[model samples]
Target: MANIKLTVEEMKYMALLQDLTGAVARDCIIDNENNRIIFIVRPGDAGKAIGRRGANINKLRRLLGKEIEVIEHADDLEAMVKNIFAPARVLGIRLAQRNGRKILYVTVDPNDKGRAIGKGGRKVNIARLVLKRYFDIDDIKIR
Candidate 1:
């Protein structure tokens, strides 16, 4: 098994998430290089954990001083990728081998492409961060 690890910032953000949602956080991964955080919550609890209108997440973001991304605990890795791209409608997502490492390629509706890749490519950056930390992928490209 690949031994997953959390940085000190990730642990701190985990505590913040718990305090915000009163929900148990299964795993926390902080990507300092990308400046984001990803965490897992119980099944069927993604909305509650996010709170009404994302108030919970907003509060945590303010407290932790980092961008926060949340996903429901999922067993299937592809589903997890889909979850991250929710609201944007990813037409297809593929995992391919590149130089002996995994790379994620995400396809979104042509019209919604800009949304998937936000201003300064922030959204795509977040997706790449989560993909690397949670899926153990090394690279990501949205095409």
Candidate 2:
């Protein structure tokens, strides 16, 4: 696990999430530029974090006035990357070193590339941020 530091607002949001859904949050990323907050909940808690009919997440979105995306935490980097692109079928990942930095080349289902990249590349940016923080990955390239 990485050494995660939470800001006051993040801690507050996490507390609110737990209170609302009874789910344990492993990490929280505040994407102000995108007007959203991403929460990585404990393994096996994704469904709880989302709640029945997505009621919990919907409530949080309304309460925070920001979009809420909850992802399940994974024990390994490969799984974490996969989780980051959930709903988009990832075929594989190739790890390579360059300039003494680690980079990831991800191959996903051709048809879902746009979805994986997301609107205005928001999803890819978030994936880069999360992977850089947690795994020291320098960058990612989608194939």
Candidate 1, RMSD to the unseen true structure: 2.4
Name the 10 consecutive residues with the lowest summed lDDT in model 2. Answer: 69-78
Off by over 4 Å in 2: none
* Regions more than 4 Å wrong, model 1: 7-9, 33-35
- lDDT scores in order: 0.76, 0.90
Q: Tens digit of lDDT per residue, candidate 1, span 15-61?
A: 77777788778778676776677777777778877899999988888
lDDT of 2: 0.90
TM-score per model over all chains: 0.80, 0.92
- Candidate 1: clashing residue pairs, number: 0
